[model samples]
Target chain A: MAPQGQVTSVPDDGLTTRQRRNRPLVIVHTGEMKGKSTAAFGLALRGWNQGWPIGVFQFVKSARWKVGEENALRALGEVHERTGQGAPVDWFKMGSGWSWTQRGPLDDHAAAAAEGWERIKADLAAQTYGLLVLDEFTYVIEWGWVDVEDVVATLAARPGFQHVVITGRRAHPRLVAAADLVVEMTKVKHPMDAGQKGQRGIEW
Target chain B: MAPQGQVTSVPDDGLTTRQRRNRPLVIVHTGEMKGKSTAAFGLALRGWNQGWPIGVFQFVKSARWKVGEENALRALGEVHERTGQGAPVDWFKMGSGWSWTQRGPLDDHAAAAAEGWERIKADLAAQTYGLLVLDEFTYVIEWGWVDVEDVVATLAARPGFQHVVITGRRAHPRLVAAADLVVEMTKVKHPMDAGQKGQRGIEW
Candidate 1:
């Protein structure tokens, strides 16, 4: 496959690999297909393996979703704590519940989204993690819970060598514009498209 | 955050979650975007946590490119072999080198691809792994070395409840049609677009 080059008004700076590694980046993953969060989680796993502090902040995922990547990452954290080799990690779910009846039980998705965004902002300010995954965060912009400009500004001005990864579909134009790296997942075929339901262990 | 149901004509089977767990799956990650192999590695890690045997077949990755995930997974494999916990893993890079100067270095990319496919087929027939990741397999099909139809048929009939994940770009249509799941990554921005090459422990 061939990905088109970066598109938009703000262009990426011509930084060498060493300089680039030292610079913080805002990476975005938005798409209509699966793997956005999965890919982001993969990146987090890579970062953790490199001994970088990692943080995963889920904005709108169902609280009960309990993804397999989450379990694996948490296990990695435990392994690190037990043996001083893995990266320190943290995972947070600010979204509501899963289940057919209790889907997003929160009365105000907007408020919850705002709260999630605010906390992430604080983390960015403190540069608490070298690699921070804002899992499913595009939902906040998609649902109008957070302003795109604020996100772009915050990410643009974030301190330290922190690398932030945002994941979800329908990322705002401004967010895409501000990102240093962006990936849009396009679906070609999926099991559910064939009437298959999500499976455990693999799905969660 | 949420994947809308499948949109293609291939409807997923009405397999119960338990049944799905018991059935083998053929998943593909293809596109121009980054993370195709990364996501596949993450899945392997999750499966390893569940004590499933994992195998990674690298078809066309540069011989010198030893990804961080490989290191991490191999370490996990070592841990398992010593303590009898995590899943056993085997990593193979069959297809020759990368670079215009040393492309394949084997005179015949097609023959090398075929040989690689043949070995994987033997492994599948032997049910050598529960979670087999055919990393960069699409390159073989893309290069017309192996028949997509044959590849698809082999996976469709593979033995055991083994899950196979093929990752690369430009997946063939027949391959996509035969896949249980497919993700096409679209690049919005890349570090290389900014003249920043892949960094050690990050891109590799």
Candidate 2:
């Protein structure tokens, strides 16, 4: 066990501390828990504190859904820009409407997601952000809007000091295999089992 | 699938939206994933945005360890106080001395942890904050420094609209049972598996 209550056994990563610091990270947050995206946002927040520009791309959620993280991060970015203390944060989303809706026509959804992926791909090639949050990106691969192999290869070959954090449930095994860090959030209990809907501040 | 990517099957909590809005929550963050503590901090940030007071209690890691989250949260609390945005945040840690070294004398460790838990218990009873982060509280129970049953009962019986967030790996089962929400972070892959140690910005 680690110094804390950690029960999981971590295998040897087999790298020098220097190598670990310099190497870019590909992190996957999957499983059936509530904090995958939130964790990624927290990470982005951390990176923002370090003055690393952040690029957040949402694959499944629509443009209408206003997540609190987006607002908070953007405000942080503004603070950084005005005072040169933190980092800049950019947000983007896909889908036709709110995530609750039908994605605004199934056919259009696929095309829109594809276009979004293309833009992110271009940005990745250009090393747009130090930290790139692919929020809910697994759905695109799961829904066949993007190929898993292509994503795996693209991320593996992405240039510069960029870090990509992907969040979603049921991440493809191949993607997991490529990740330097993969966390599967398991659900033990939830109020939603009792039929409580999502709230504005807490849920969003 | 939830309206979002939430996978937890929350059962009928027998709470109306208003009741839930008013009721304090017991949120447990467990499992082997690296982001357990990070996620809890993220949740705290979310609560901070709502003008909720944040109280963080660390059961492991010395008070000396300078976590990036602590600094960021402290800064955020400052911003909130100055600009009438976000919320206030307080951070505390326990260990023998500072964070980097041993747990002082092994014999005094348990007593120290118990003392720390006592303070947190008092705070919970008083509803000192809207969001109470029992960061790494699981270890105390795992090490027998504190009684899990007592902790669970106290949490279940906590009064007022206080949200408690507990984080660590190998959480006690009874604690999970009493929790309204539990997230188990499963580590699929880690840089530690390759022998790379924790990084400054990413790990802390």
The number of the candidate with the highest lDDT is: 2
DockQ of each: 0.43, 0.42
Clashing residue pair totals per candidate (backbone < 3 A): 7, 19
lDDT of 1 by residue, A1-204 (tens): 445774344336666545655566678888898777777877876788788888888777573454666666776776678787758888877745212123555567787778778878888899788899888788789888898888889888887678888888898898888888888888888888767776654675
Query: Candidate 2: lDDT of B71?
Result: 66
Number of residue pairs clashing in candidate 1, backbone atoms closer than 3 angstroms, sequence gap of 3 or more or interchain: 7
Query: Considering every candidate listed, which one attains the maximal DockQ?
Result: 1
What fraction of the reference structure's interface contacts does model 2 contain? 0.54
Candidate 2: where are CA atoms >4 Å away?
Answer: A1-20, A62-66, A96-107, B1-17, B20-22, B62-66, B96-107
List TM-score per model, in order.
0.80, 0.81
What are the per-candidate TM-scores when only chain A is compared? 0.82, 0.83
DockQ of 1: 0.43
User: Could you tell me the TM-score of chain B in model 2?
Assistant: 0.82
- Candidate 1 is scored at a TM of 0.80
